[model samples]
Each structure stands twice: as structure tokens, then as C-alpha cells.
Target: MAEPYYITTAIHYPNGKPHIGHAYETIAADVAARFQRMRGRKVRFQTGTDEHGLKMAQKARDLGITPRALADEMSSHFRVLFDRLNISYDRFFRTTEDEHHRASQAIWLAMEKSGDLYLDRYEGWYSVRDEAYYDESELTEGEGDEKLSPQGTPVEWTVEESWFFRLSKYQEPLLRFYRDNPEFVRPATRFNEVRSFVERGLRDLSVSRTSFDWGVRVPGTEDHVMYVWVDALTNYLTGLGYPDETEDFATFWPADVHLIGKDIVRFHAVYWPAFLMSAGLPLPKAIFGHGFLLNRGQKESKSLGNVTDPHELADRFGVDQLRYFLLREFTFGQDGSYSVEAIVNRSNSELANSFGNLAQRTLSLIFKNCDGVVPPISGHTDADTALFGHVDRVIFQEMPANYDTLAFAQALEAWIGAVYACNAYIDEQAPWALRKTDFERMQTVLATLYIVIAQLAVAVQPVMPETSAKLLDAMGLASELRDFEGIRSHWYPQLAESDFRLVKPKGLFPRIEMPAEADA
Candidate 1:
């Protein structure tokens, strides 16, 4: 049996429409999930909306709608966007789901049984925009003497009767865990930040709120609702049928990684683990907090009137094109900037002119010169052997190693290197010229190109699933032979022996034109 691998995205807070940041994180998670499946892992991927919070409540009141009505409307937009981006999440979890409520309450009861829960009067600086409480030490001054959270969001003094979790009780344990498992958080910078925060003394955390009713109701309490983070984080366990310990929970608990934006690393790294420990559940293996996506080097914000709708971007640039550009243009753990020109340039140069052209040229050669049939390799030249070696090393070894570590840019960089190698090899070999000078040699060259082109398609499936599938299908490659192992098999010679005929190929990536405004 394949080893089970589970991954999740931070459930998005759907108080607003989905933006490019949401699209970036979920698409990256989907890439990882698809990559794991390509490696023969039993993968369970989850993403969804965190619909219960003070933020949602306020947004609903402003619109004169009930929170449920607001949640329903906003959650569907997220779902539609994820679908549009071809996100292959196994479960689109919602905090409003009944099972999720039960799961959250069950975990609450477990923590209560563990004596980590107690009633208390809570007074603190809270950021409604962040849905987080801030320590006085963590607050800063804003305009007109207003207080702000570290994220520069407005903070107000909030005082209420609340339920507290003994977060301080797990302070030493959390530090010890960090010390023992240094890789619990990713991108060393985030790990360092999380560690420094935990090293400082932990105060008891406000786990329930009395001021807001738009949240998960506490297990045995009528008036208090669970803190938004508590309810939101439980969606991970809820997706796996947590309280029941069903087959999914038994098989895929202790998620391999939680892919989230860098802004929330503190909650996932510190509070989430402590909550799991309090509830006697195993902590997830890793937390990777990736950086943000910027618009032309500036953060996108509604106030700036530059917040880009991801759906619009997807419509303008193809879905796979956007997916490829996001992963390729940025180092995985660092912030990246994108613009219309950047997208168009990257897509045209890498996808359209390079890999897409390589496939189109190779397949077109076979269609015209080899009578639209799979051509057999009559002999191999030194150049052919060299091309094969380079491509095999990249596709089979380097790409996978980088991808395993979530080094998406590096992996794609290596992939494009291999593509360039093939393009160079094709040009030098001049298979078209070989048609008159030597027919068999032309067949041999075209055959070699065909094999590597198919391999490249298989290698790129995780990033560009639709485009890769279209290219591979046009080449008459079997659907079953599209994985890492399957691509490296001797299926190529067998394919050539079979009487499979290829159709004239359509270009997978058309050159994207820069919008006139972008040119300006």
C-alpha cells in the first residue's frame, strides 16, 4: 500500500471576495497534492472557507444580512474560484458544517477534560481585522494616537467574560518541541520567528468570546462561542472525521504539512500545536508559511484600489499559465510581484516559445515526416545519448528532489533547462534536413525527441495538468503511463512498436498578448 500523505491550506476567511493571495496559496497546495499523488502516495487535500468570526459578523451587519446568509454567499465565491483554478482538494470544508461544529465542540470538551480550559475575565487589545488578540507589547501607535496590531490593523480595547485556555502551561513543552523538531516550521526565517515568540513567556489565551455569537458555540456553554482561530483550525481535523476516528482520520491524521500564508505562521506554529497537545492529538509534521503575492512590487489592498480579482487574471491568462507563472517567477518562500507584462512575458517565453514549441515542432515532424505514426529509433548518436542523460537526470532526479522540498521555482528552473536542452538538440540535429539526407536518422532523431517530450509532459503534470494532458493525449501516450515511475519505464519502445497513430498537434500554449494599458 502507498504511504498516506495529507496536506491542507489554511481555510480562507471569506469575509471578502477571493483575491490573488488566496489563489496563490491554494494553487500551491494543489500542486503539492498533485505531486504527491504522482509519486504514488495516498493523498488527501483539503481547503475551504473559515466562515465564523467577528469579521464575518461585522461584514454581514454592514450588508444587513444574517451571518449565515453572508457566509453562504461568500463561501460559494471561494468555491467557484477554486474550481476555476482547477484545485483538486478532496474536501472543501466549511466551519459552518454541522460535523465541523461537532468536531470543534468535541475538541473543546477534550481540552476541558485535560483541565486546560477555565472561565476568566478577558481584557486585551484585539484586532477585528486580524481576528486576533494582541499583547500590549506587540501593539504600536497609529495615526491620531490610535493603537494598531503588529500587522498595522486597527486595534481596540476589548473586555468581556470569556473562557481561557492555559496556553502558558504548554510554554516549556512548545519550546522543547521546537528544540527537538527544528523543522516543525519551514523556511528557517519563519521557524526563527515562531521560536522567538514561544521563547518569550506565553500568557493564557482567550479561547472563547462572549462579544460575538457568529462562531462555534462552546460545548457546554450557552453564551460563549469558541475563538475564531480555534474553530477555524479544527476544520483540518473535521475534514478527516476527527471525533469518530474514521478510516480517514486513522490513516491521514498528523498531516504531512499545513500550507499557509506567512502572516498566520504564529497561530499554526504555536497555538495549533499547543491545542493539539492539550487534546492529546499528534501535531502535524510541518508548517510552511509561504510569502505573499504583490502587484507590481506593491501589496494589493482595497484602499489602494489595486486589489486584483484572481478570476479576472485567470480569465485573461489561462489557468495553467497563471499557475505556472506564480510558481516559476518567485522563490517558493519569498514574496513575488506579478503584472500583466510579467505574466505575458513569462508565458510567451517559457510556455509558448519554449516547451510548447518543442512539443509542437517534435509532433509536427512526426506527423509530416513519419506518416503520423510513432517512429522507431534506428540508432542513437552521441548527441542523442547526451540529451537523454541530461533530461533523465533533470526529470527523474533533480526536479523531484526540489519539488519534494517545495522548491517550486528551482524545480521549474531545472525543468526549463531540460526543455532548452531538447530545443537545442533538435535544432542541431536538424531532423527536417535529415529527411532528405538520411530518412532513418531523421526517424531516429524524431523518435528521441518524442520520448523526451512525453517525459517532459509527465514531469510537468503537477503544475500544468490540463496542458500536459492535452499534449500527452495528442501524442497517444497512455493515461496510466503519466506518472514519475511510469514515465521512466520502457513504455516508449513499446509505444513505438504499437500501431498507434498521432493526430496533427494543436499548440498547448498560445502566445499571450500584453494588454494595451500594460504596454503604456
Candidate 2:
């Protein structure tokens, strides 16, 4: 049986329509899930909207709609975008679902039964935009002497009757867990930040709110709803049929990774684990706080008039091109910027001109000169052997190592390096030039290229699923032979010996044009 692997993207808050950042995070998570599946894991991937929150209530009021209506409408946009981007999520969890509400209540009751819950009068600064409470020490002064959250979102003094969780009581236990599991938080920097915050000290956390009734209602309480984070965080479990100890819950609980944005590291790394500890549930294996995606060195904002619609970008640049550029252009867990020119240039230069050209030319040669049949390898020269070794090192060792560490840019860099080696091999071998002078040698060269090209297609499936599928299908590769392990089998020799004939090849990555305004 394949080992089970569970991964999730932070369920996006749906106060507004989805943005490029939402698309970026989900796409990266999708890639990770796909990669794990490619490695023969039983992968369960989850992503969805966090629908019950003060932000949702406020947005609905501002738009003269009920929160449920707003959530339904806005959540569809995110679902549409993910569908368009080919996100292979096992579950699209919504907090408003009855099952999720039951899961949230059950977790709250578990913590309550554990003596970690108490009613209290709460007074603190809270950011509605962030849905987070902040200590005075963490607040900074903004214009007009206004207090702001650490993220620069405005905060207001809040006082209400609430139910508090004994977060402070678990501080030492959490520290011990961190000490034992050094890799619980990723990138080293985010882990240090989380440890620093915990070392500073923790206060009892407000887990229920009386001010808003738009969230999961606290058990047996008519007026107070469970705090948004409590409801929001339980979503990870809800998708797996949690609180019932179902087969899925037993198999896929304690997720392999929770892929979230950097801004929410504290909520995931600190509050979430503390909640689970109180509930006597196991913690997730890791929390990876990935960096933001900036638009041309500036964070996208409506006030800045530069909030790019991810749908428009995907439509304009092609889904695979956009997916390739996002992973290729940026290091995971570090902030990266993108522009129209950058996307277009990277796609055209690397995907279109380099790898795409290599595949097209090699297959076109086989289709036209070799009479549409996969040519036989009469023999291999030193150049062919060297090319094979380089590609093997990349596809087998370097790329997998980088991907395991979530170093996506590094993995793709190794992949492109292999692509360059193939291009160089083809140029030096001059398979086209040898078509007449040495037809047998030419056949060997084309066969070698064909084998390596199929290997490249299989290797790149996680990043560019559709594009890779197009190339592999065009080359008549079998579905079962598309995985990493399956690609390494003796199928290539069998394929060449078979009667499968090559059809005219079509280009996969066409050059993307920069818009006039983008050039300006």
C-alpha cells in the first residue's frame, strides 16, 4: 500500500474575491500534492474558503447581503479559479458546511472537557481585518496616533464577554515540542520567529466572541460564537471526517504539511498546535509559511490600483505558462516579484525556446525524416552516453532532493539545466545534418533524444501537468508509465519495438507576448 500523505493550503478568507496571492499559495500546494502523488503516495489535498468570520459579516453588511449569501458568491470565485488552474484538491472544504460546524463544536467541547476553557471578560486591541487580537507591545503607532497590528492593519480597542482557552498553560509544553521537533516550522527563519514569540510569553487566548454571531456557535451558548480562528483551524480536520475517528481520520490525520502565507505563521505555528495539544490530538508534521507574491516589486492592493486578477493573468499567459513562471521565477519560502515582461520573457526563453523547441524539433524530425516511426538505436557515441548520465543525475537525484525540501526554484533550475544539456547534445550531434550522410547514426541520436525527452516529460509532470501530458500523449507514452518510478522501467525499448507511429507534432509552449501597457 502507498504511504498516505496529507497536505493543505490555508482556507482563504472570503470577504472579497480571490487574488493572485490566493492563487499562488493554492498552486504551490497543488504542485506539492501532485509531486507526492507522482512519488507514489496516497495524497489527500485540501483547500477552500474560511467563510465564518467577522470580516465576512462586515463585507456582507457593506454589500447589503447576508453573510451566507456573500460566502456562497465569493467562494465560487475561488473555486472557479482553482478549477481553471487545475488544482487537484481532494476536498474543497467550507467552514459553513454543517459537518464543519459540528467538527468545530466537537473540538471546542474536547478542549472544554480538558479544563482548558473558561468564561471571562476580555479587553484588548483587535483587528477586524486580520481577525486577530494583539498585545500592546506588539502594536505600533500609525498616522493620527492610531494603533495598528504588526501587519499594519488598523486595530480598535475591543471589550467583550468571551470564553478563553488556557493557551498560557500549554506554553512550556509547546516549547518542549518545538525543542524536540526542530522541523515543525519550515525555512528556519519562520521557525525562529515562532520560537521567539513563544519565548516572550503567552496569554490565555480568547476562543469565543460575544460581539458577532456569524461564526460557529460556542457549545451550549446562545450569544457567543467560537472565535474565527478556532472555527477556521478546525477545517483541516473536518475534511478528513474528524471527531468521529473514521478511516480517513485515522489514515490522513496529522497532516504532512500545512502550506500557508507568512503573515499567518503565528496563528498556525503557535495557536493551532496549542489548540490541538489541549484537545489531545496529534500535531501536523510541518507548517510551511511561504512568502508573498508581489506584483512588480509592489504588493498588490486595491488602494494601489495594481491588484491583478489571477484569472486574467491565467487567460492571457496560458495556465501552464503562468504555473511554470511562478515556481521557476521564485524561491519557495522567500518573497518574489513578478511582472508581465518577466513572465513573458521567462516563458518564451525557457519553456518556449528551450525545452519546447527541443521536444518539437526532435519529434518533428522523427515524424518527417524517420517516416513517422520511432527510430531504432544502432549505437550510442560518447556524447549520447554523457547526455544520458547528466539527465539521469538531474531527474533521479538533484530534482527530487530539492523538491523534498520544498525548494521548487532549485528543482526547476536543475530540470532546466538538464533541458539545456539535451539542447546542447542535439546541436553537437547535428541529428538533422546526419540524416543523409549517416542515417544509422542519425537514427541512434534521435532515439536517444526520444528516450530522454520522454523522461523529461514525466519528470516535469508535477509542475506543468497539462503541458507534460500533451507531450507524453503525443509521444505515445502510457498513463501508467508517467510516474517517476514507472518512467525508469524498460518501457522505452518496448515502445521503440512496437508499431506506434508518431503524428505531426504540435507546439506546447508558444511564446507569450508582452502587452503594450506592460512594456510601457
Candidate 3:
């Protein structure tokens, strides 16, 4: 079997429509999945909806529909947006699925059998909007008679019969886990935050609720439902067929990473690992909590009237451009601000001017001048040799490391640096003018350019799949040439040497005009 690699995005909630923030997370996970697949790994990429929550129940009630109906309708919206965005998740699971209920109950029983779960009366400050409970010390007085959680969401005092997990019991072990495995949480800052929270001490987490009837029922209880986060987080294992002893479960039980937003880092980094430890299960290798996508530096919220739809964004700007701009515009772990103006600027300058222009110009030269056949160089100068070596070095060496670290912007920088070098090589050699004076040398230069463009096409496929396929096809290369091995010295040169036929290549990305109303 190929080496297994499993990655997942925090599933979207079914209470709301999918937004740009959801798309950002899915696209990031997709990029990682695609890169790993191209590198010959057996990859399982999971994304889905969290359907069981008080928010969903209330939203369904307000909408005059059943919660399951609401979940079906809203979850379909996420699927549609993901399909449009080309997120290649192997499974888009829903927490309401039968298998997921089993997985949740299995873990619950295991933890309970281990003496970590206890029946208790719970009273706490809860944020319905956040699906979280907060202590008085952690809350600030909001409007008159209201208190807000640390996240600024309004809280209500909630009391109920509950099942509590011994989260406090795991605090020391969690600290030791963090110390022994420093890289278990990413970007260092986020890891330290989680550590500090553990050091301040942990409270036994309420893991089931009697007040809500919208979630998975507690394993042996008739009146209580699993806490929404417990039900929600188990979807990860459900996607892998946990408790079933299936091959996917056996191979991918300990996921390589759990990709989540910063807002929920505590849930994934603190509560999740503790649950796994209690159940005698291996933990996920990493929990990467990435920053939010802001609109004009403000969080996109419905009340703010600024929640941008992913479909509309894709409709306005091409899918590939949106994908590239979102990933490249932000450093992967930091907050990123997006605007129509910034989108147009980056699209026009980088895609249209740099990559698109170079591809179209070079491929058009080959079709018009070289009889629709790929041309091989007659000779190699020291400078020519150096350029070829540089492209080779980037393709085989630097890019894999960049993708491994999730440094997509830095990866693009490396690929585009080689792109710029190819552009410079064209300007210096003047391949177009050389076609008339020394046809063979001109063919050589164009051939060199062809390899550079083809290599670039392969490198960027994770970010811009459709455009990259188009780029490769226009170069008269087969679709099979897309794997990382395609860039290896063994196969690429042989194919480049053999091919002389080419297709008329058009501009891959069209420049978008600035919208009349965009943020400054």
C-alpha cells in the first residue's frame, strides 16, 4: 500500500450558509491533499458539516422546518460551494449520519469505562452562538444584564443534568505531551496559548447535555445528548470508520493533521487530545489553528451584513484566481484581509502579467514558428545550463519542503522566482527575434522555455488545478505528466525531447476590471 496520509478541515456547521471563511479552510485542506496525492501518497481528505447543535435546532425552528431538513438543505449548500470550488475531499460527512453516532457513542463508552466520565448536575455560563461554556472570570460584562464570553459572544446561565469528562485530570499529561511533542500544535504562538490555558488549570468538561435534544444521544442515556463539540469532533474519526476495524481506520486512525480555525483551537488542541488519550487512542499528529479571513479588517458576520458568499466570489472572480489570491495573499497561519481591489491587483499582476502572459507567449511562439512540434536545444551554454539546473532544483527540492510546512505563499514565491528567471532568459536571448536569424538556436530557447512553463504548471496544480491542467494540455503534454515524478529528470526530459507538436495557447487568466465599489 502507498504510505497513508490523512488530513481534515474542521467541518462547517449546518446552522448557517457557507461563506468565504469556510471556503478558505476547505481550499487550504484541498491544497494539502492534492499535493500529497501528487507526491504518491495514499491520501484521505475529510470535510463535512456539524449538524447537531442548539444553533441548528433554533435555526430550524425559526425557518419552520425540522432540524434534519435544515441540515440537509444547508449541508447541500456547502457541498455545492465545495464542488464549485473543486475541493477534492474524499468524504464530506455529516455528524447526523448513523455511523458517526456509533463512533461518538463508542468513544463515549470507552472513556466512561475508563472512569473518566461521571453523571453530574451542571451549571455554567453558556454561549449559544459560540456553542461554548464560559466561567465568570472568563466573561466580561456586555450590555446591561448581559455577559459576553471571551469571544465576545453573549452568554446565558445554563443549568442541566450532564455527563462530565475528566478534562482536569488530563491537564498535567497534556502539558507533558506538549513538552515532549512541541510541534503537536502549530505556528508556536497558538501552541503557547493552548499550553498557558492548561497551566491555568482545566475544569471537568461537560460532555453531554439534557437541555438540548438536537444531538447524538449519550451512549446509554435516554434524556441527554452528547455535547455538540463532542458529537462534532468525532466526525473526524467517523470519516475514517472508527470502531469498525476497517482498513481505513487501521491505516489512518491517527490523522496527520486536523486543520481548524483559531476560534476553535481550544476544542481541537485541548479537549480533543484529552478525549483521545482517555479512550486509549493515538492522537492526531498535529492541530493547526489558522487565523480568520477578515473583510476590511472586520470579521465577516451576518449581523455586520458582510458575510460574503463563496459562490458569489467565485462567480465574480474565476475560481482559480480566487484560490490563488486567498492562499497567496495570506501567510498560512496569520489573519488575512481581502478586498475586491486587492483581488484584482494580484490577479492582474501575478496571474495575467507574469504566469499567463509567459505561457501564452512562449506556446504561441512554438506553434507559429516550430511547425507545431516541441524543439530541443542544439547546444547548451554555461548560463543556459545554470538556468536549467535552477528550475530542476526548485521542482525536485525546495517545493516539497514548502508544501510540507504549509508555507503556500513561500512555495509560490519559489515557483514564481523560477518563472521570473525564465521570463528574463527570454528577454535576454530574444527567442522571437532569434527565430528568423538562427532557427535552431531559437528552437532551443523556446524549448528551454517550454520546460520551465511545464514545470511551473506541475508545481502550481495544487492551488490552480483547472488552469494548470489547461496549461499542461496546451503544451502538448499528457495529463499523466502532472505527478511530482513528472518533474523528475528521468521522465520530463524524455517527453520534452520527443514532443514537437503543440496547440495554440491562449491567455490563461484574463485581467479583471476593478469593481466600481471596493473598499479602500
Clashes of each: 0, 0, 4
Q: Candidate 2's error at 161, in angstroms?
A: 0.3
Instruction: Tell me which of candidates 1 and 3 scores higher on lDDT.
Output: 1
lDDT of each: 0.93, 0.93, 0.88
Query: How big is the RMSD of model 3?
Result: 1.5
Q: Every model's Cα RMSD, please?
A: 0.8, 0.8, 1.5
Off by over 4 Å in 3: 490-500
lDDT of 2 by residue, 1-520 (tens): 8889999999999888899999999989989999889898999999999998788898999999999999999999999999999999999989999999999999999999999999999999999999999999999999997998999999999899999999999899999999999999998999999999999999999988888789898889879999999999999999999889799999998999999999999999999999999999999999999999998899999999999899999989999888889999999999999999999999999999999999999999999998889999887889989999999998999988887778889999999999999999999989889988999999999999999999998888888999999999989999999988888888878888899999999998888878999877
- Candidate 1 on 398-417: residue-level lDDT in tens? 98998888999999999999
Model 2 stretches with alpha carbons more than 4 Å out: none
The deviation in Å at residue 315 for candidate 1 is 1.2
**Which of 1 and 3 is the better model by TM-score?**
1
Q: Model 2, residue 443: displacement in angstroms?
A: 0.4
